[model samples]
Target: MIGAYTIGKKAVTFGYKRYGIPGAVASGGAALAGYLIVRRALKRSTNADATGVESAIDAGEVKSAVEERGLGAVTESETLERAIDEEDVGSALDMNDVQSAAESETDAMTEGSEGDSSDER
Candidate 1:
């Protein structure tokens, strides 16, 4: 009976010693996974906001450029005109339309540059 008791005590002591390491490892892994998820989500949100801002800037730029250069300079300029009409608040000075125009212009520039690069290859 005493031998059995000693063996059981030894087994419990060994288990206790091993348990701490595995417990710590599991906790660390969970924390890392949670941190990575949060980081990725934040990055995605930031990128979306940046894209929105870029679009607004493009619209403004396109409006100014057309005003300075003339309507003939803009290719497919009707898109910007339509966005302005959809807003329907002002005729000559609409901020939302300016933003949309800027975005479209930026997108065009990016695509054009990419096309050029691909053609070179």
Candidate 2:
């Protein structure tokens, strides 16, 4: 157990010497070269090798759909809309017809209730 502890401590010290502390203060160029060589040997965690900058933007890791930053006053901005669709127009007409039917039914029920109360009197 004592031997194992000593070996572990030595291994951590070795790692810190090689990479943990940025380039040695004694030599500039050689130290930087050593650091670069060691880094090249290690695996990179970025997708830079597989995708280009355009792909990165298209992937949209940074979202853009948030409400715009503005003052407290509410203001409306005209947004670009798609050309009017036939299906949308048809659905709107159908919705208006259904609304009219519902209103007429409600009015008839109200009149019927009033007539019943007068008859009871």
Q: Which stretches of candidate 1 lie over 4 Å from their true place?
A: 1-91
Error of model 2, residue 68, in angstroms? 34
Q: Note each model's CA RMSD in angstroms.
A: 25.6, 30.8
Model 2 CA deviation exceeding 4 Å by range? 1-93
The global C-alpha lDDT for each of the candidates, from Candidate 1 onward, is 0.36, 0.26
Question: On a 0 to 100 scale, what is the lDDT of residue 36 in model 1?
Answer: 26
Which digits, one per residue and each the tens of the lDDT, describe model 1 over residues 22-67?
Answer: 5444433333322222222222323334323233222333333333
Clashing pairs in 2: none
lDDT of 2 by residue, 42-113 (tens): 112122222221221211101111112211101111110111112322222222332333334434544776
Top candidate on lDDT is: 1
- Ten residues in sequence with the least summed lDDT for candidate 2: 58-67
What lDDT, from 0 to 1, does candidate 1 have? 0.36
